[model samples]
Target: MLQSYETLRQTGIATVRAQIRSGGYASHTAGLGRNLLQANLAIIPQEFALDFMRFCQRNPKPCPLIGASDTGNPILFTLGQDIDIRTDVPAYNIYRNGQLVQSVTEIGDLWTDDLVAFALGCSFTFEHALIEAGFELWHIANNVTVPMYRSSLETVPAGPFRGPTVVSMRMIPEERVEEAVAISARFPLAHGSPVHVGDPAAIGISDLSAPDWGDSVPQPAGHTPVFWACGVTPQAVIQQAALPLLITHKPGHMLITDVPDTAEIPIITNKNMPR
Candidate 1:
């Protein structure tokens, strides 16, 4: 029998990956493997691999490069002992010439010798830390994907990859915002702290109800929207580049890794604590 989402959260990472690999679990990966690292996927041919690596180097916040597979290889040895990139991710967004062609549960048929898979750090890695600190993430509570937006903020361009930065939004209580920021900053690989807080208009986001990706989460009274650099920025940039081929993990459908979250030990300082 398939385990409940709540039950799966308490399960081991390998079991979760197994379920995902078999097409048994095809949902957003938020709140799963709370202590494990999760990554965003960006697979392209070796011809554009160098440029993509440079792009990630130039834009570290949204594209924190964690691991990459050798050309034609589907195994991400650095992330896990048995992760097969072709099937480990719950879903993949296929693109041809920068246009989304389809979304699929697996990409084994498309895996080729010239393809190189890059894994970028995802903000989902730090979500557990936020929850442990008593911050409420409504999307997870409601079993929906976190809301993501394409902001007016520009990314540092490299090669053919350049586009406005993408961000994930979380509605946090106004009073606990500072602690949330401080706690999250410890996970730099997870996009670190929020890039913007409060007022979506300040960052070129005009509608809170309409998101470019993921589900629109509720905004309760006295809560403020906090935005973090999102790994999905690569999808937007790759779209602009119009590459002949591109495969990325569907937004919020990430590859959970065997590595544990490397969040730094929190410093007990009065300044960082909530007022």
Candidate 2:
């Protein structure tokens, strides 16, 4: 059986990495690593690195770059002392010419000298904040992956990378909307605040029951579906570019970083939040 989120909090980061490294644990990381920062992963060939980096720059909220690897380096030393880009994340999604081709626990076999990995801040960061502040997340309370959708909004193009913005939704009580926004805003590393609140249809999402990625959370009475820019935006956009290979963390399987959720970094990975 998979470890419960509460049980995972007791498991240290090193042990968590060990479990994943050995192929013993391959579950979503929503509630694991309680006080630690979590990151979304994106790996691509060196030829596409600069443009991908620029793509992230043009779209900061959905693709908040937290840490990136030097081309050809498998380890991401900045996020954690022992992070191995090839094996740390629980699962990886391999995209071939814009389509998901496979999901694997580890990518060591496919490691190449020309690949660069990028780590982006995740919504998991603010989840810690919400829980700490006593706000319940629709997905976590019910134990499901956060619901994500393809929005009608278009991202600023960077080279061949461009697509509609993707968003993750959480149904918040009509009352706690401000609190949800305030808590999340503290962690700019995470995709900070809601891009759209109240109505999913306004953002071009027609069905709350159906989503592009992850399972849909229950939308109870007295709640509004709140949407935030998601890390998946870059992967979706890059996938549209039809790259030979693009690697990203399977939606909820994030890299648990050693850093605390509130640690203010001098530089946010490659660039600052767009002004």
The candidate that achieves the highest lDDT relative to the unseen native structure: 1
In candidate 1, stretches whose alpha carbon ends up further than 4 angstroms from where it belongs are: 263-275
Kindly provide the TM-score of model 2 when superposed on the true structure, using C-alpha atoms: 0.93
Candidate topping TM-score: 1
Cα RMSD, each candidate? 7.2, 4.2
How would you encode candidate 1's per-residue C-alpha lDDT over 200-261 as one tens digit per residue? 99999999999999998888999989999999999899989999999999999999987678
Every candidate's lDDT: 0.90, 0.85
Residues 1-275, model 2: lDDT tens digits: 35555576678887787877777788888888877889988899999899889989888889888888888888777777677878889899999888999999999988899999998888998998898888888677666789889998889998899989999998888999998998888888888988888877888999999999999777799988888999889888888899999999999899998778887651344322222
The true-versus-predicted C-alpha distance at residue 27 of model 1, in Å, is 0.8
Report the error of model 2 at residue 129, Å: 0.7
Off by over 4 Å in 2: 1-6, 266-275
Residue 241, model 2: lDDT of 94
| Clash number for each model | 0, 0
Worst 10 residues of 1 by lDDT: 265-274
